[model samples]
Each structure stands twice: as C-alpha cells, then as structure tokens.
Target: MKYLIVGLGNIGAEYADTRHNIGFNVLDALAGASNIAFTTDRYGAVAELRHKGRTLVLLKPSTYMNLSGKAVRYWLDREKIERENLLVVVDDIALPFGTLRMRTRGSAGGHNGLKSICELLGTEDYARIRFGIGGDFARGQQVDYVLGQWTEEERRLLPDRLKVFGDAILSFACVGAERTMNLFNKK
Candidate 1:
C-alpha cells in the first residue's frame, strides 16, 4: 500500500521551527529516522520511504499554510494516492503542549491549512494527526503565537514529543487510522 503523508507548513526559512511548523518538524524526524532526504518538487519537498512492502510519500508543501491544499491535491492526483490513504500532520492550539490527537475526520477548527484541504477535497473524511501547540497567548495574539518560535521550555521537550508523532504516523500506515488512533491518541 502507498500512503501520502503531508506536513503542512510554510516554505520559508522564517517559518522554520515555529509552532505552526510542527508538522514539518515531525516529518523531518521521521525522514531522519529512516535516513531519507527530501528533494525539492513541483509544489513541495518530497521524500519516499519503503518499509515492509509499503511506500510512504512524505510531503512538505511549499505553497505556504493557507494554500497548502493546492500542493496536496496536486500530489494526490499525480501519485494517484487514494483519499483514504492520505494523512495530514498539523499543529493545533486547542490542546495542551505535548498532546497528540489523531482523528479520522473533523472540521478544520479554524486552521487555515486544514480549511484549504477540506475546501479543495470537498470532504473532511481524511485522517489527520494534530500536534498540540497550546493556546497560551493573550487575546488577539493567535497569529503571532502560531508563527512564533517555540519557547526554550517547549524546545527542550520537543524531541520526545516528535518521536511520538513519528510513531503515530508509522502506525497509521502500518495498520489503519482507527487502530492507530487507539494506539497513539492521548487520553
């Protein structure tokens, strides 16, 4: 089976390691663990990993966060990967830091990247892994918080959290969304 694993984040260096870029960070860890490198592609950075007869296609969209669906749709069509086999990794502000949530389907919860994906795909039925960045900012500081770099404390705890995210992604591909959720979702 083939799975399209999309990490939603902006393309620029300015966005690197920001709270909203946890998706990219998680995928980077996964790729590093497998010793796979991503190459610049038409609309994103792409990497391929093969394990136990399954092919995992890792994508980091270059279209920025709000326009991520364009890259996602393009790759899905080009790769002919089924919608059911697609998994999106994104940051979430609703949950506390270090929390991970996997859902089979859901609304975007005001996340621009996820909103774009749902708009382009016309469905929210695909699987997604939400890495909680926490809503710790004061009122009207949402954007700054999301785009800002992580605090020193958060940076210290990030590696282990990312490992959990990587494991969840692999479990999703090796098993299935429901089973993977049961195995990895924070309770």
Candidate 2:
C-alpha cells in the first residue's frame, strides 16, 4: 500500500522549533531514522520511506500553514493515493503538551491548516495525527505562544515524544489508524 503522510508547518528559519512546527519535527525525525532525505518537490519537500510492505511518501508542505490544502491535494493526485491513505500530522493547542490524538475524521477545531485542507478536499473523511502543543499562553497571547520556541523543559522531553510520534505513524501504516490510535492514545 502507498500512503501520503503530510507534516503541516510553515517552511522558514523563523518558524523552526516553534510549538506550531511539531509536525515538521516529527517528519524530520522519522526520515532521519529511516535514513532518507527530502527533496524539494512541486508543492513541498518530499521523501519516500518503506516500513514492512508499505510505501510512505512524507511531505513537508511549502504552502505555509493556512494554505496547506493546495499542496496536499496536488500530491495526493500526483501520487494517486486514496483519500483514506492520507494522514496529516499537525500541532494542536487543545490537548496538553506531548499529548497525541489520531482521529479518522473531525472538524478543523479552529486550525487554519486543517480548515484549508478540509475546504479543498471537500470532506473531513480523512485521517490526522494531532500532536498537542498545549494551551499554556496568557489569554491574549495565543499567536505568540503558538509561534514561540519551546521551553527548556519542553526541549528536554521532545526527543522521546517525537519518537513516539514516529512510531505511531509507522503503526498507522502497518496496522491501520484505529489500532494505532488505540495503542498510542492511552498515553
């Protein structure tokens, strides 16, 4: 089977290591562990990796966070991957930091990346991995917090958290999202 695993984030030095870029971080870790490198492609930086018998195409969209759907749609059509085989990795502020949630379908939950994707895709019937960045900011500082760098404590916990995110993705490809969700969502 083939899967298009897209990690949503803005591409630039300014956005690097921010809480909002956790999706990119997860893909980078996964690619590094698989000994693969991404090449700049039509709508994103893309790399291919295999786990067991499945082919996974990893993408870090260059379309920026709010316009991510264009990149996703392009790649999905080009790769001929089924809608069910698409999984988007995105950061969510709703859950506590380091929390992971995999859902088969849902609303955007106030995320522009997801909103654009759903708008372009014309449906919410797709899978997504929402990595929690947590809502730890002051009442009016949401933007700053989301775009801010990780705290020293968050940095210490990141490697292990990213590893689990990588594993959850692999599990989703090999065992299916439901099983992966059951396994990882308990943590």
> Which candidate number has the best lDDT?
2
- In TM-score terms, candidate 1 sits at 0.98
* Candidate 1 weakest ten by summed lDDT: 178-187
C-alpha TM-scores of all predictions: 0.98, 0.99
lDDT of 1: 0.94
lDDT of each: 0.94, 0.95
| Residue lDDT tens for model 1, 1-63 | 989999998888899979999999999999999999999999999999897789999999999
Number of backbone clashes in candidate 2? 0
- CA shift at 134, candidate 2, in angstroms? 1.0
Q: Over the stretch 1-187, how does candidate 2's per-residue lDDT look in tens digits?
A: 9999999999999999899999999999999999999999898999999999999999999999999999999999999999999999999999999999999999999999999999999999999999999999899999999999999999999999999999999999999989999999977
Model 2 residue pairs with clashes: none
Q: Candidate 2: RMSD over Cα atoms?
A: 0.6
